[model samples]
Target: MSENETQAEVGTTRRGWTASKVLIAVVLTAVVTFGMTALLVNILERRTESAQPNHNVVELSDTTYDPAVWGQNYPQQYESYLRTEEMGLTVYGGSQPIELTPSETDPRSVGSSSRLEDDPRLRIMWAGYAFAKGYTHARGHEWMLEDQRYTVRVLDFNQPGTCLNCHASMPEVYDELGNGDREAGFDTVNAMTYSEATQHASGPVACIDCHDPDTMSLRITRPAFVTGIAALKASEGIEDYDVNRDATTDEMRSYVCAQCHVEYYFDGDAGNRLTFPWAEGNHIDDIWKYYEEDGHIDFEHEITGASILKAQHPEFEIWSQGVHADAGVSCADCHMSYDRSAAQKVTDHHINSPLFDANASCGTCHSDDAETLVNRVVTLQDRFVVSRNQAFDALVSLIYNIEEGMANGVDEDSLDLAREYQNKASFYLDFVYSENSYGFHAPDYTQSVLIDSMDASRMGELALEGASREDLEASEVTQKYAQDIEDRSDLEFLR
Candidate 1:
């Protein structure tokens, strides 16, 4: 009851409060110290692990065609590589598996959606060609060989061994065919029947195709790409350019993909030799010029007896026209973006669209969030689709007009001019269509291509209406170039 007793109680409370504050501070300090220590240890471990060499359980060689064999040495990369089998859909691209009833002829019970069925216009576009028979959506790298082997394009039609050049891992086949001379093997394999050449392919693309066995550095293994790049460089005034020797590491990242992703043709004169038409350049116009000079026709259009040039996937060429390539971003930078596996950074081998992992892919350079980046990509693609549809519709209208013209007994010169226009329109439109990017790779460039395609279709329509060749011809510059090419061709023929 005394004042002293009250003061004593107050002092006891103050002491207890001070002791509680000290206890809290000590616990906080210990927690902070522990976290910092753990973080430092983690950093050190990661650094040490990254610095250490990859421990190889088995020796790989040029003969090692199995990806599983490569997996033993670089498990992280191999693991990601195997994930290529995982199929899912993105907004614009990425494969979605479609279930199929396996038949004796085609043993696969699952496949991607048919592109031909998705757009019947493609059938008309590729009429009189195997592609019109059947063309399916592209699946992962793992399915490349299997899809090629059993597709109606190969099953119902006659195909050269050259078709297998990009579909399967060719190093082993090349070795077997050419007695260790890959170029010779490439020549031999390309000349064989698809059935015979396919017999030698071990599997889809493997490590040896893109990587050196000893150093694991990127290399160009495809002879076609080697010749293609050299020709492309030569056109740029760089004579005797060897991609394997001259390309930088960053350039190789894209060049390896360019091997199979660019437009190509079979040189019948050279025994169906698989060839990339980059002798002039990789641009659509340049490619058109090259084809014009070569006079290599794929097939005669069934609807309009036009000599047509088939444009295969031209991803590399399209991408080269994009801002990403301008910024020096490689294909591997996006589709095969780098990710950490435990302690080391490795390129993700599950090659697919950047949309699936925008943060890991696009986010590497762009500061935008994943969803925003994806939406930006989709917006570009949406615009591209609108333009593409317009161009495609125009092309289809021309095809129909040409058919009608033929039925109406149009003059041969008029019909021929319209057919030539159809060839350009179809090939240009198909170039953009076949490219997997859906115009996200180079939005403006892609739009320009579509516009040109639509213009070609318009010119074809005019030709059908009996427009003069002089009026229907391309721009002054293009006309001059065409004349020069014709002049050169005549000179060469004389020689």
Candidate 2:
């Protein structure tokens, strides 16, 4: 063939190739568009399904204690709630039971090489209080009533009726006491003895605690929460704040959990009235100051003789300062996220640490995969463990130092400041120690708290060595606080 014939043939081949490519691209585009449209439709369908409330079962009473009654109407949520009975352990959180033994040489050490070990310092710190007798690892919400009934802290110690505030189906008790008058019910129940209150616990934490029966709109049932939140708002300069009226839907998601999972105390003078010490700010220091200025000592330290304060579960308070809260995430956002597939969508009421269901909990907001998020969480917890242990070691040393100074004939006046240091130091350390998060909830805040705790512990130790209050207050830990260096033979140290 000639050169012109060859060029014409080559041009024809090129044109044919271009035509084939265009046809393939059109087919691929149609498939991609169809897939995207289907995905969008499915998402919208799930949203609509979840948005519509469950309306299948019978009507429930406002004061229903049995979750099964609520379960009848909301089977998915109720069934998920039952999973709290599962004793499965996550990496850092969960109520997987671990055996703890009081150390043979040191009864104060509650952990026998397990995380369940109650810091030995806790015994010293909570001395003369019921917690000193019995404190255990916190379990799931299902055990709220069970734990309360059986703990030595309750049985051995004389807990008032106010103890029932968070552990029982409080709505039912309220109804029984006030003849269905919720407000009047609170006053009546508040006056009951612990034994009388025990008779009132119908079941575990139930739907009525956080919901309005007629509408199923979230409502605060506990009277303490109503007053506590009002006080909290007042502290923030909001007058006459009513939770049922003032709280936004987004705020209700968190406010519901905050009802129970917050720091509280029994107001001994006025009929053991359950109180949230939020008249001050929610910070560790703020609460401490409130306790100090108000002369609200939980117990006198039997060993150090310092009037000490006890912290309850303050998850909501501490978490309120974290990045998640700042970014508008609620407790329910992670703990009660919706689990939707092609068929159904509803909130998973299996309330737990977000670490348990990373895909639904963390992955919902995070771009990372579940495994990455889990690992990231584990790393954060590990950091807290190191800091917490450091603080713990320092605290134990301080306790021993104070005891030693007392044994060596240190004057009560000079050692009085040491006792004061021990009081503040242990409170700081125990605040983090008792909180269930292990520091995953608020990493930066957790670290700063632990750092201050370590500083206080070392200061207490130095005060035992004749360090002045000014020096103790200004001093910082330049080295590792000593650990497990206590003399076991000393009578005061043994106590």
Best by TM-score: 1
TM-score of each: 0.85, 0.80
TM-score of candidate 1 relative to the true fold: 0.85
lDDT of 2 by residue, 342-418 (tens): 25568888887777778999767788988899999899999999998888888777777787888999877668887
**Cα lDDT tens digits for candidate 1, 295-406:** 9889999888899888888999999999989999999999898864435567899998778889999877789999999999999989998998899899889999999998
By summed lDDT, the worst window of 10 consecutive residues in model 1 runs over: 9-18
Residue 281 lDDT (model 1): 89
Clashes of 2: 1
lDDT of each: 0.84, 0.74
Candidate 2, lDDT over the whole model:
0.74
233 Cα displacement, candidate 2 (Å):
1.6
Q: Give the poorly placed runs of model 1, Cα more than 4 Å off.
A: 1-53, 340-342, 474-495
